[model samples]
Target: MPMAANEIEALIREGIPDAEVEITDLAGDGDHYAARVTAESFRGMPRVKQHQAVYAALGERMGGVLHALQLTTAAPAKE
Candidate 1:
């Protein structure tokens, strides 16, 4: 089964409590999604590493239940 947006957000938040996550259903099928995750914890980390963090948050569901996630990650902008 495809993953729900809230489930995805919750998983990411569980891993990075400080993250501000925005999830969009890209295809309206509940399978394809786009996630923009902003967190202070991502600071100083490379883009790949940041993505890895979010992936780790999702655990084993990445390629099985939660497939086709277009993820974008960034550190929060300074005010």
Candidate 2:
């Protein structure tokens, strides 16, 4: 079973709390998704770690249910 965009976003929010997440179905397939996550907590973290946090949020679903995720993550812009 493929993951829904809202499900993915909810999971990320559950894990990251303050994260702002946007999910898009790239190929109009439930299996392929692109996520843009921005959070203040991501500040000072390395990009790899940022991605790791999102992957962790998805847990086992990443490899099993969700096939492909094109993820982009960042800390909020300085204001």
Best by lDDT: 1
Quote the positional error of residue 2 for candidate 2 in Å: 1.4
Cα lDDT tens digits, model 2, 3-74, are: 889999999999999999999999887999999999999999999999999999999999789999999999
Task: Give me the overall lDDT of model 1.
Answer: 0.97
TM-score of each: 0.97, 0.97
- In model 1, which runs have C-alpha deviations exceeding 4 angstroms? none
Per-candidate Cα lDDT values, in order, are 0.97, 0.95
Q: How close is candidate 1 to the true structure, as a TM-score?
A: 0.97
On a 0 to 1 TM-score scale, where does candidate 2 land against the true structure?
0.97
RMSD (Cα, Å) of candidate 1?
A: 0.5
